[model samples]
Target: MRKKRALAGSGAALALGLAAGYPCLWRHACLTWGATAVEVHREMPGDALLPTAPLVTTRAVTVGAGPAEIWPWLVQMGPGRGGAYTYDWIENLMGLDMHSADRILPEFQDLGLGDTMRLGRNGPVMEVAGLDSGHALVFRSQDGAWVWSFGLYPSRHGTRLVSRNRIQPPDPSPLYRLFSLYVMEPGSLVMERRMLLGIKQRAEEPIAGR
Candidate 1:
């Protein structure tokens, strides 16, 4: 029975490795949620709006690659493509459909100052207010509640990636405030950690355009 259990565990690990990509590290690196404040719960898209909060958590990761390499992964992020790379399994378990990156097609047409860069099946749905190629990009919902930014910098080893999300305090509601502090903030921390690791693995890999 013990031997059978060990084999089962090994089979599960192998399956995960295949799902992530060719190399094992790509998936393994993302599984570890470092120093997270709260355990994560998965939910489908349109499940429910995030509980309103006063402030959002921000996190950073240093990758062993260049900014050029990391930028593609960020700008082309979505449900199918690279994904937010935050809490993927949680998103999947929640019945939210997981997406693949191969469907991405980013063309540099009509890119202008203050013009929101748009892509994916839904055009301009996700907007980044502050965008600078190879440096930083900020994503915010116009008139919506959540805002996030991705920053990159040259590092001794490669580059540094920073992700920040801002949660606006909701209308007068005590329950909303409480959920933000106890649930959302902690989940954000966990997701941010995973996001960085995912980028790191992809950026460091020996791929074209990196």
Candidate 2:
């Protein structure tokens, strides 16, 4: 009975993510896309082989301003809020895209955990968590599909922002590891860089410093 229940649960989980049109199943729906193929890698120094960590990747960007300057951009990111720093041309070309980074609270002070950030046409909503004022913010989705965070620190020039994502396969499918290393990691790299760039541009522009 226990085994049967577990199997049933797994099936339901998979079914839930496999939305129409997209062959791929989303652990947390970001936006519907075609089947994406990714490659996974597990490596460590010489003799010490660190067990494969849950396909995590990190991307970094430098801002000309301070963390306080950069905080608002991240907090404001959402579909209807702040448009994602990503390229508008490319995103629009992709078709039926949603989820802009700018979508967020009107007031920065209101930003906090449990806030639901939505995307286009019922795309997955990332729940805010692990928020540290002007320091860090983490957004997570159900099924452990996405664990994205931003960490800000002082730099000699100005401020450095690092965005990290840790993704876990919703199911024990072989494709999970591959996608983490290849597709998701690369996508994260591209998106995070654009995000930081957008933050930097906005922060450096005119805005009352906090």
Candidate 3:
């Protein structure tokens, strides 16, 4: 009886601890991960992709390659092409049907302004909004509600790949907005972090036959 009571007490304590710590965890995930204040505040070329003020997320990684080496991977990202370089199982569970590419495919590398990419069979998810070859690419949602941008800046060793996401959720009640913020903000961070790391790994890998 005593052992059972002790176990129950410990479980309750653990639950309380998690409940208390959740807000801090959520804030860290939403506001700052792999990003500095300077990177977050600096205006990126793709900022003009959206006209409205949005909840912005900025994350970055350093890759041991130049922008040119990294550009091909970004260009080929989508369903039925090079998949989003995140956890494919999780995306598949969400019905995204992602199959992340290991090698750059020549066919998918010619992306241009106004081109569309699908998330699944569910129609267009992102449209090329603006691009500067070997430097930056920005994609906006078909409805113009979200903007995701990738920018590569020359660093001392290689390149700094910065990703910025700006989101304007559809008009909803204040309560619903709050709920969406808590859910979507952290979710985006998790997926985007995986994507950044995936791109970094791919970019740093040696070129085949070279």
- Count of steric clashes across candidates, in order: 3, 17, 0
Instruction: After the best TM-score superposition of candidate 2, give how far the Cα of residue 50 lies from its true spot, in angstroms.
Output: 17
Per-candidate local distance difference test: 0.57, 0.59, 0.83
- C-alpha lDDT (0 to 100) for residue 144 of candidate 3: 80
Off by over 4 Å in 1: 1-53, 93-96, 100-125, 207-210
Candidate 3 least-lDDT 10 residues: 23-32
TM-score of 2: 0.61
Ranking by lDDT: 3, 2, 1
Candidate number achieving the greatest TM-score relative to the actual structure: 3
Q: Is candidate 1 or 2 superior in lDDT? A: 2
Instruction: Give the TM-score of each candidate.
Output: 0.60, 0.61, 0.85
The sequence of per-residue lDDT tens digits that candidate 3 reaches over residues 1-210 is 999999999999997787567667657556557776888888887787674655778898888899999999999998888999999999898778789998899999889899987666764478898889998899988988888889899999789899988878777688767676666777778888899899988988874333
- Native-vs-model 3 lDDT? 0.83
The order by descending TM-score is 3, 2, 1
Model 1, position 170: C-alpha lDDT score = 53
